[model samples]
Target: MLRRITLISASIALGCLATIGPVLTSLYFANRDVENRDRADIQEFADKAMLRAELVTYQAFAALSDLEQQPGAACSPANLEQAARVIYNYRYVQDAGAYAEGKYLCSPLLGDVHDKDLTLPPPDYRTNDGFLIWFRQKSPLSDVRKDLQIGRNGHYVSMDPEAYVDLIDPARRPIAAIQTTTGTVFAVSAGADPNEMFNAWKHAGDVKSDEWNYAVARSSTRHIAVVVKSPRSSVVGDRPKLLAAWLSVGVIAGALLGWLAYRRVTRQLSFASTLEWAISRRKLDVVFQPIVRLADNECAGVEALVRWTLHEQAISPEVFVRVAEESHLIQPLTDLVLDKTIAQLGRLLAANPAFYVSINVSSEDLRTFRFLNLLTKSLQGTGIAPRQMRIEATERSFMNADATRGVIAAFRAAGHPIYIDDFGTGYSSLSYLQTFEIDVLKIDKSFVDTIAQDTASSVVAPHIIGMAHELGLEIVAEGVESEFQAQWLRTKGVQYAQGWYYAKAMSAGDLARWLGKNRAARTPDSIGGGIATGSIET
Candidate 1:
């Protein structure tokens, strides 16, 4: 009877372990999936918002084009006024105005006028004194009448919380300001707040939130308008909610299965803990992908991509990074990558002095002064010229305004060339371009993926290269996967290119021979300097 009681108790304990193990594991993986999905959803929303805003702008562009036709029934003050009203009255327009000479064509109070008043600085960045874009009367100084301007295309600026509230406080009145690109401007308080205005503009897919942060922008007219909306509650529960919900259900179904294997799972969990502990010992390394110039088919440099492996099993960088970040291991990993890449570059310089390395940085790394200081000290110790080492700063680099600027300044003072990586992937690409002292712009692969297609990329790539050149910056066309893609980029005056066309992420041992072989092939009529070893990594 005592032996029977012992067996029964042991069975219950085993059953409990069996029930919980799969449930917990399921919950963990499900949570990861959900978090990844949320990120994907956010990215999709940003992309859609951009496309929709551009479409709205094009409506204004059509108006501008019609007005320019002039005198042949294509242009009229009434039609111009109609287009102006369509844009001004539209929620997405934020503000729209027509400019024939200099003046307040759309100001509800200022009516219409052409005048120059340079004595006071423009109001609200549109006119002087940060008040009314126009004066009560004209002076010779304000010659901004003829300077018709439109907001930059694809600008995603948000105004008042039009989509959030259904009503507004009578105390917090809404106002609309107007301005011309040439500096003419005016303003007027709205008859109804944006909450009232938003009611009429409702569409098929509007969502709501309590608090949202916004980036403001303007149209051709200085009138305030809504362009894009971001949901910034930044939910922490999102990381695990889906997993938890699913695991709760999965556990009920797996009771028998769990009972059968309860002992094995406890053992595995203990093993996982030990394995994780071993991973924490700071034994990580980095590998790099050579970024080759498309024009001559020779290596321009290499981009450092990170890797992690232990006990013959390699962990996913994505998962490792997420967990590592949670536990404050990112700094150590970042340092390891930087040191290894720098060391590799130093060795490569032994045979080839011109080769360089582009290292990726995380938003966390940018926030810490210690990491930046360590970087500076490391580079200085290596004796590599600052220009030879390019720091590939992504949109993530500037998450904190003050710290990011401080970090950039430190590196810049040290003579390091800062390259903006994945330039078009973020919503703030143009804004970043205007604000940062960027020396090179690496076009994101998604945009470059369609270069061979007879689509927007064929036209857009050249325009980007031209624009970068105008800004005195070099363009690096990433993801050049085909000979046609390579040929198209070269024709468009893009000098540097990098992608699978050359090599994959590799060790310094194989890269040496690969670089030497490709370097030699670029000389004198060697298949028009084509990378004959297509898809070859030594």
Candidate 2:
């Protein structure tokens, strides 16, 4: 009766967990989609603003061309003033002026003006096709024109600040301000100082504030970029609210289901208790999956994989290992696996002392010095050199960089080579290679699987290999289950490989026997096809 109740309760709990996983996964992807859409919206706004700025700049240039076409217009103050008046009338023009040889020759505001002290700095950009220069500074005519000071010469428009502000009319409120590449700030709206938003984008290209997402884009034609931003709340909109609703519903349903399961529970059967029981009973064991050197088909080393069998059912490492981590039983579990692995491979290490064995380490294992001390003592007793034991870590182990770096440094100081497991399947940045002392990177099987398909989409695997090579790190390709994948990686200069194409996890006795038989050069297909199932347990 108790067994029947336990089974029924476990089934109901598993069903609740299954529902929760999909709900959470859906929420995650929905949030990602929202972010991608927001990026597109911001990019489009920047492009449109760029086009508007470019149009205004070109219009000024066209006016300059008209003045230059007029015979002696630049030399004659009357003609120049007349021309300036015509251009100023275009729009947003407060004053117009013509200057040459560092002195104003003409202006509609000041007729026949010549101020020897008047100075205009150089342009940020130049054009040889015409006498044109672009620059920005405080208005020399601030006394006369309260709002006009910034000018663009050669059809120079004496524009008020409103001139720049007006270009962004019917704007997507994302336009916080407009500024010349030459450093003149023009506010587009009256709210929070747009200069602050503009400066953020100018410095970083993209930035986010509590209320807004700021971005900067330069016109292909003009020297300045439009400072575009969107309300942070608008970008996320109601998606987060919807996600919250779904999550709330899921939590309520889970609670109800859990309650029902608990009422039916005959005896408490936690995974933590089961694992501890199994550990004490010595039901856990280690299996070795050979890491073959692709160049010579020689077994250079073996990765130690932990296996657990409880209640006549073989539990997957993914399941039990995660349970161990959550229960804080990982350190003891890791010690057990390592202790057993060394005992089993003691003969192989004695015969070929150079052979290395790789074992996986978690972030929790690295946060403390206990594992480090355990490793040192274990190897010291077994007569295994530090170089003969490779430490493997999934990229998630480095999420807290400061803590991870100390762990990595400790391993390096002890002389154990480090390998990054499942490289392309994590949040690992290219920065990790530079920041951490990594020796080998294992390309995930997902990338290797792509190469077997006859499609252009598979170029990523080769690129990953190329990137790893450029960083001066050795490469290991996982899941080379086909001759095609194997040959491709080999040609791409991948030094090592691990997959069923070489061998599955086996007992020490079975591996020693299989190694004796498979020393010759063998194609991936031949090796994959002729695997002796009776010799090695999957």
Candidate 3:
């Protein structure tokens, strides 16, 4: 159960990691792409605004220069007519005239305005090229309140201040300004304060506020700076659509990767690995099936069987035992069985010297002396005699007689009786059985099940019994599930048997209670099916 839970947790953690990786990658690149596009748009707007400011300044200077070359007195008729032509030719110039002693002398729309009170205020700024500029000065001629004035060479041009920022679309509500590099504002749009925008651009070439994204551009050839800004919402439009598309792809890929990871790890924890884990942790259980003396139908000994339960599911011994042998885990598995059998039944066997428990071992265990050494150590201080723990091996374990002969002899030398379990089911013949000095032969359950049945296999059991008798071997009939089979085996001189005819295999505590009940009722009539016919009294 714990192993199952751990496997599930590890798989989920890996799945979450796989999922988060692609989503984060998509988000990072998406945000970066959007920011880059917005920055590019803002930069283009700033560049266009700078070009407009430069063009307006260039046209003002050009008109002033043309008016200065009129070839007569500053306010003469020819010069005044020339001023009309200058105003007509220059698109941004509203007025062209002569100025001296800080007062307008004459021209064009207001001809000879010397008596018109056209005195100019102090110039707002002076350029490096000896030009004077007045930003948004009130016009004396009419209610036109904001005009830009520039003077050079005793001539001046007056222009509308709105021309510097007129390119902006009013519906978009963008903020724009044109100013000198020294922070003199020429013109500005309505939404944002000119001084604040200039200060933001001065400290940072471009800046982002909660509501806006700003960009700045400066003209190297003129004392001009342009600042432009757009709303943050406009720059991030359509971003939700992009996020949805990328997120869908990420979820699909993450789910695929996560599923593959889960399968790969689950496959790694197969039955072989699980069985190995159980043996190492000592989680396997040992149960004892009582072997009865056929003559008196009394319990004589037992056979130790190993069982396993995984995740509330019982794993069959036949399946897991084969898996262990094939995967080379049989030796450790046999060691665990031996250790548990001794630990659970050691005291019981010590008290009853006539009782012995048969333990099964694999072919690999008999191929070396390691198992013999382990057996010696397991019984050293347990007060359990070697004869009380009989060693049982299947016929397949005797395949290599030369390799196993020494180990078998060592076990017998240590006072352990050896029994060959599931006999007549493998390659051992009567002549082959003569090769090892084995004590007992356990007839296979298949032959025992065939007793009294009208089948050809029923005759095979008699031949196996006759063969064991000729070889001077004790016979223990296996899987005798009925009184008829038990009576037949006892009539054929089988001395011992183990099957569900008496009781099923059980735990140590249950077996103890069973033995107590059987001992208290020793009469022949107390046995199951009232003792088989032709049975002898013990």
Candidate 4:
């Protein structure tokens, strides 16, 4: 029942990870796209600001053209005032003035024309390409520039940094630099990664300012690019609501799926687990499968194989052992099998000292250090020499070389021999054979069962045998079922063979009787009713 719950929990956990994986992956990519868009949006906004600056720069040109168009139009103060008012009335024109070499004769749109410091020569300014640069930056936002100061208007104005802005109409952020055809200069907002943007903009930079992204380009002034940057925090500010809604839906769906999976699987686990215990308590019985030396047809040992005593209810070691391993019951069951086999071995000890007994201990049982001590203690004083005991450890046990060597050393010192079971199926087995000191290498059943038919197995067998011989190791080829395969193994100088070809695993009494036959069955195919009638009763 508990095993059922554990399996259900595992399935549910896997389902949750599967469902959440994609959602988190999508969220990561979505945020990256939003950041790219934010950069584009800023650049677009800057482009528009550059456009506004162009209008200011070109107005000066128009003023010069107009003066030439209307001869002596600036002769009278009143007329000049009227012209200044007309020219400066254009939208986005903050204040306009005309200064000519140390005199501001008149100003339009301002009540006071003769203002302070008009006598100062052009306020220490310069003109380049028919445009003027100011000694100091002029800022409309400051109160000092509230009343216009008169000057000669020697083609000089305040630095453009104060006036630079990429507006959503009226609002502005100061920028790095903007240059005019008439050589007027305006400061540009230093948006993030501005150097990259400026290169793209000045060389016909593109505008990508969406509401979520910002990129502004100005083709008019040789492509001065402006990017209004929204910090990542703000750019992704609105995403939380959308992501939250999606996340909620995903989590709810995942939970529902998990619940269903857990419920259905847990119920199945309960059923399977119940069956297991039921079989374990009343049905589990040991059957002896004789491990034989094919060369002389002599019994070397008998491996204790398990069976469900309930006939017509075939249970698979494939499924049974798997669940045992997963649920951590393999260790307990291994102990049970080992102890029972040893007790059975004790009964046969007097009959034959040469006959060894082998039991399969799971990989997990070996890792549990306590298992070793417990096993050793149980076998103590049984008059069972460690040499008389042989343990078949599956490949998984040897996967951890350090641990396997440590345990094997302990077992060997205690007079027990350890064989790596299910060889050829795991990684680095040949390498391990070279590195670790082991007594036996049991070939995997897959290769053992197909020795004659599989070319790979046929070729690999010789190489394996040679390697084992080089290592002074004994080789046990399991799952042999045919006379031809057995004879082939004998010819290959295989030391041991175990499979249905000799005898199916049978109960202790049956095994005792069978061994009492005292005669070797040479041909497996000749056995009557697919069974061996030969029985040895000692």
> Which is the leading candidate under lDDT?
3
The digit string of per-residue lDDT tens for model 1 on 1-538 reads 9999999999998998899988888887776675456445444333333323333344444333333323322124553454454345344433333333223333222233335322322323432322222222232224432222342111111122222222223233233222224322222233533343233223211343443322222332323333223334333455476456567767656765776687686555434433333333435666778887666677767788777786778877776776656644455567677777777556454334466788877777665444555666676655566676778877766656776777776777777788888876665456657776778888888778877568765566666788898888988888878888788888878878888876778876667767667767666664353332222222
Q: Quote the positional error of residue 122 for candidate 1 in Å.
A: 66
Superposition TM-score, candidate 1 onto the true structure? 0.46
Q: TM-score per candidate, in order?
A: 0.46, 0.49, 0.50, 0.47
The segments of candidate 1 whose C-alpha lies over 4 angstroms from its true place after superposition are 1-282, 310-313, 454-460, 524-538
Candidate 2 residues lying further than 4 Å off, grouped into runs, are 1-269, 452-457, 520-538
Give the deviation of candidate 4 from the true structure as CA RMSD. 36.4
> Once superposed on the true structure, which residue ranges of model 4 sit more than 4 Å away at CA?
1-260, 275-283, 309-312, 452-454, 518-538
The root-mean-square deviation over C-alpha atoms between each candidate and the true structure, in angstroms, is: 21.2, 26.8, 42.4, 36.4
Model 2 vs truth, CA RMSD: 26.8
Model 2: what TM-score?
Answer: 0.49
lDDT of 4 by residue, 191-298 (tens): 434454454434443434343233444444342333343434342577686467567878778777988997898666654454445433434556678888776676
Q: Tell me which of candidates 3 and 4 scores higher on lDDT.
A: 3
What lDDT does each candidate get?
Answer: 0.54, 0.68, 0.79, 0.58
lDDT for model 3 comes to 0.79
Ranked by TM-score, the better of candidates 1 and 4 is: 4
Predicted candidate 2 versus true structure: per-residue lDDT over 1-538, tens digit per residue: 9999999999999998899988888777877677667667666556555544544554454445445444555547655655664465344445556676555565665556564456556544454554444333445656543343333343354444444434333434545434454465554544436568667656754554556666676654455566766665342478676566567878778777887887555122346556755664457988888887788676778899999987889989898898888866676688788888778876566456657889998877766444666687677766678888888999888878886788788998998899999987888688877889889999998889899577674876888889988999898888889888788888889999989998899888778777767753565654543323232222
Clashes of 4: 39
Ranking by lDDT: 3, 2, 4, 1
lDDT value, candidate 4, whole model:
0.58
Best by TM-score: 3
Q: Which is the winner by TM-score between candidate 1 and candidate 2? A: 2
